[model samples]
Target chain A: MSASATPVALGAARPGLFGFTRAQAVGFLLMLAAIVVLPHVLYPIFLMRILTAALFACAFNLMIGYVGLLSFGHAAFYGMGAYVCAWTLKFWHLDAAAAILLGGLTGGLLGLALGYLAIRRSGIYFAMITLALAQMVYFFCLEAPFTGGEDGIQQVPRGTAFGIFPLHQDMAMYWLVAGIFIAGFLLIHRVIHSPFGQVLKAIRENEPRATSLGYRTMHYKLIAFVISTFLSGIAGATTSVVFGIATLDGVTSARSGDVVLTTLVGGLGTVFGPVVGAIVTTSMENYLAQFGSWVTVTQGAVFVVCVLAFRRGIVGEIAAKLRLSL
Target chain B: MSEILLETHGLTKEFNGFTAVDNVDLQVRAGTIHALIGPNGAGKTTCFNMLTKFLPPTRGRIHFKGRDITGIAPADVARLGLVRSFQISAVFPRLTALENVRLALQRARGNSFDFWRSETALRRYDNRAHQLLFDVGLTGLADTAAGLLAYGQKRALEIATTLALDPEMMLLDEPTAGMTHADVDRIVELIRSIRTGRTILMVEHNLSVVEGLCDTITVLTRGRVLAEGDYATVSRNPEVIAAYLGSDAPELAHA
Candidate 1:
């Protein structure tokens, strides 16, 4: 490789907490404050469920936003992680952290296999390939012996952290999930601002040019896909532990669509968009559960509005208006 | 004679039954501007594409710096010190001109996979990218997004990006195809001033620009080399003159 070093400096230093823009820091802090205080104000178990889903949405955004890939079947990895965690806890009697790690490993392996094939195509083809693969997994989960057919692996034991602290209480589980969510969120942020993330963006913007510039665009894409899936697995594993069940619902196409909806409602490419989007969408779904098919119709309307007038999503529009890269 | 930095032996490319590039041979010596000129559809761009590994040749071999590069991936070919600029501008439109050049520099340095460090800490690369922008007369527009740049400025930024690769050979396909006279002059001057110790093979439709910039010229007709020499000799060749008689050839034949 030619050692022609050229540093490109554009824009001023971002001023805020942890090198984030002011708005991003403020938004994150506000969300953190809410999560910290929500248990006292609302049902702790419900808040924990929303937080778990939010983490998954953020993980999904890591792929969709930074890598510019729309995966319609992320539920494959999420559902797989949930099943693996439930099985391990129910049979192997593993601790919570170990179960989550095992779930991440399962997701990572699947990502490696699926991403290798999915990255071979681009745009709508990539999305379709992932959806097809996820559907295959969904069928496998429904028929698999360990998954218990329709009943799934029920009454999954909520093992302790390293077999030390008890994870029996909802508050303890909430803190643990919150910690994992923040870490995963920060890791995704770090990856995006890193050189690797820049290459992904370059590939997203112009794959041909990126390839001509000597980047193995496929390799980058696969790596991003794996990381996104791994984080989604973490979220799934946490959900299985907290809720004490792993069901086929986790693997359903609707669940996959739900994550996409959350990311879209928040912002497709913006960093913190998925987090906010997850909380809002999950809360809306909870409140609208009694409305029957109207929830689906309302979600569709939101997607249409976001695509038409607010293509940038809530966070994207704000970032664009401020001339800040979120 | 200068050392040959790039050589192709009977390179051929066929799409279905039609030959896009047929039995083409090329030699580019180090540190010289070699111009490839031909009528439209005469396979000039196809030849450039093959040379850059963008299109796989149906037959024959390409030797760059004495290594067989035929059938290699385009990215690997670029890493071997060969780079090409596109006929239409190919750049990250959302990225600033400086970021585009920086990306090239990052690739050149092989540090693009570093996921832990802040991009701003890549001071050496930033300085070099800035210098490249300055060299391409785009320092003033460094912060401008490539999509927002003027037509001429976008082209200039593309050149800056190509330069950041520090290739041993540069292939420019129709570098001045859609430019005003002033923009053409600026590009020609920029190409002339680049002293990166690399050979430049350019396909140019602007005869005057090629005449002024090229050390040697190859003219093609119907995917065959009809004439090869400096401007004066090829301009007067009978076959070259006959090739120019075809309709719509005047635009490419003007000196």
Candidate 2:
């Protein structure tokens, strides 16, 4: 095979406005421009909601796409981070950045512990183990008092950054959310291109061969899991601050499934696929809210279609046609 | 005489009540091709597995380079400069041929986790991998994905990967089991070239290939060593003739 036939590095020469690949960078810049400009023309609250979901979807993709590990219980970490941040901000009166960091740490710890066990198996078993463990966390959240159970922790303080800069408005929160999303995206990109990422791909391709080649495959899997969950936690913390709520909905299996659906729709192992998938799916959920059960039916149908006919996903399909690795 | 590189004492394998390999003592000298030929159900592959540390012997001691490594992990065994190629090709299908050799070199050099440097920049590894590919006559297909390579090419690549480890000894189980005549001839030639530097212990079924490539041959039947010596002596032995060729044997009549 020719060297060109192999998948190349992401955003090699043409880094967009936000350090994304040319296409993503261009699309993201346009989206950012729209976020800044269109909010005046459209509703700021609606856009913020979409942007938050997009960030969460991108974080989820860090695991599924780059690492090739399907996490069904990502919502457990996401919801846990959200709850930890919300509770800390509301009861302990912590700053927003600190709360988000605390949320990320919590998610990382959970990932470290759960990933150790889940990575013992591969393929479908790995997915099931993660889902089952996440369910345990979900049950704990439902019963835990700090989480406020069905009521959720409400009126979380969207405290200032470092006690100086106030993020009291939607515009300010949008910038923060966008910045966090971009950072997470860049980190994921760095990891996928790094030598560490190459080993993960090697493991994904053939675990036995990787092991025989002297790799501690389980260690790599755990690290990837932790990184993925930690990013997912950042999204959760941001969501809590933006909406001033933390609930069991974030930790539910359905919520986890939603992230998978988004990643799959965007692209299974593609970098920008999850972001695009998140944006499109969140918008569909928002507009189809009035359609009741049909919204779920429609989402399920999209997932089925993506899996059966478009396994490469929207971003993957585009990349294949254009002969790019984006 | 060459130095002994691999030695086993009381090497035995038991699967439940049945003993697959029973008290087989073996010593492979350096820089010679040692062929272990056996009929079906003979414990040749099991013995290979034991030597490579893939399967722990039920009762035995294996010493490689004067170090006891009876129950070490397979990776550890490979790291110790004793590598084994599988009966079936086990190359990474997704990786290109160069990448596969590069991975082996990385492991052999204990650099499996060197994440910061680009693989392309590792000139030493890249050059050695390229050289090994050339040595195996796979220089033309360096960029081919191992999975896409032809059967003969895959086998050649497997040998190249094994060589990338820079092993002192090689344990190859059925290297030419499924190859065509041309492929088999190519493998025999490759084995011949490789035996100049490292001790090679191979399990082969084809008598002609065994006679052509092996300096010493150990004939096995029903989990026991039936005959041992050079091909000329073992081929003429009555026990080997009875066990391997059976009663209707044209070669035995000539002998």
Candidate 3:
């Protein structure tokens, strides 16, 4: 094996942190600084919203951007996580960390079940199956007694961290949310640059070829699906905890659409695109709340502009122009 | 002359009542280049698909290394040290040449499920991958994306990735289908150099490549084996000449 004595040194240099390029490392540092400083400049709650949205978009990007599996019913995991987290905090009296972990587990379990069915088919059919299954989850949430129907699980206590640190303070909750977002973001980066991620990219590039090379493409796709949904669940649970409510809005198809929009606007495949996209889109919605329906009109206009003018989204276009993976 | 490494019995495929490959049996001895040469519509690819388990046979059984493999998955078939290359060069186009070979080399690290570990863990494969590329004369193009390479170079990269598997047997489908003469000769030499200690099953339209590189040739016509022999014996068969060579039989005999 490999008996030839050629000394080709193309891959001699190791990548920067977590396989990130130097530019990407710098970008990551800048993002960290922003996360740290932005809470003081902007309202902490608004910043938290952006953070949760960014986390959710990043999770969703794992499917569409990397694995090429566009999950149209991601709201199932997110909304289910929210409902479960709210229930645990309100009824079980679990701390914030425990509740969120339970919520994330709920998402993962739901993903395992639904992803099993959805991944049986591919392309639009896969998207449709996830949508249908998620719709079922939405209906279950709507009809379930614990979800409180239209009222949802309201006034979910923010509770304490590890039974010690209280999360009632906006700054405390912001820190927790920010920490989750950063962890989720770094975890995703690690996954994307890992050996498993290389196989996933190969499958995305040419699945049949990957299969011929002895990779179980379905298994890889399924695992990626579960990871994506698990993270989406975390984001949703955190949102419910922050807002003190778990409502039907969290499970609506519109939530799924919002995530897809954010990922698209930020960049489809780039590592940091979803975070940038979440910041832009979530900020727009928060600031334009006074403008009512015009917010959607503005969003639609921006989406159109992005699609036509820069198909790569904001980060994608930047990465393409600069020849650096952001 | 040696033990049969791959053997098929009554393998058939039917698509909507149209039989693509009829009941055809084939065998390849271990460590020899076997060629499946046929006319344009002779079911060579369909038969190759069945052997690779890419398509489930309508009725058949395939034995690889004396184990039944007809009912297994394509990836499972590959994992058993029986790999196949596509007629069209099937490199992961976006990946660089080194990355393409590194992909096949990664199975050495057990399974491809280490998503939590950084890709730097895969750097161990770089040297071996580079060697495989060099084996196929792609040393200078290791950094180039597979998509950006010239056609011959892309085909060579495919071979490099295939070699990274170190398969016991390889199924090459039309390894020199569309090529300049120089490229074809280069591929022939590449195949010749890599043939030691491995069995190769190939589908070819280029009879001269078969004559030069293949130890045994199986000629197919109308989804059935028409002749099986070494270069001179099969080339002289009147039926093979009439069906596959037609009026060009004399020129083929000379070749």
What's the lDDT for all of these models?
Answer: 0.84, 0.79, 0.89
Put down candidate 1 lDDT per residue, A1-326, tens digits, no spaces.
Answer: 01111121224344344447776777778878987998898998888778788889988998887777889999999999999998999899998999998998888899999889898887799999999999999999999899998999999879798778789988888888888888888888777777787788789778888988888788898888988999888888889999899999999999899999899888877777887787778777788989988888888888888878977678767776776666
Can you rank all candidates by TM-score, best first? 3, 1, 2
Model 3: lDDT equals 0.89
Q: Against the true structure, whose lDDT is highest?
A: 3
For each candidate, the DockQ is: 0.50, 0.30, 0.56
For model 2, the DockQ equals 0.30
The most accurate candidate by TM-score is 3
Across residues B86-201, which tens digit of lDDT does each residue of candidate 1 receive? Answer: 89888887777878998998888877877665555445787888899998888777777777788888888888898898887788889888999999999989998884576899
Query: What order do candidates take by DockQ, descending?
Result: 3, 1, 2
- iRMSD of all candidate structures: 2.9, 4.9, 3.4
Q: What fraction of the true Cα-Cα contacts (under 8 Å, chains A to B) does candidate 3 also have?
A: 0.71
True contacts kept of each: 0.64, 0.30, 0.71
| Two-chain DockQ for model 3 | 0.56
User: Alpha carbon lDDT of residue A28, candidate 3?
Assistant: 91
Give each model a TM-score.
0.94, 0.86, 0.96
lDDT of 2 at A210: 66
Question: Considering summed lDDT, which 10 consecutive residues are worst modelled in model 1 chain B?
Answer: B246-255
- Return the candidate ranking by lDDT, descending: 3, 1, 2
The digit string of per-residue lDDT tens for model 2 on B1-255 reads 978889989899999979899888888888888998877778999988888877889998999999999867776777787788888787777677887787777766754554444433334677898999999999878777787889999989989987877787888889998889999999999998887678899998777788768888887777777888998998888888888666335544563
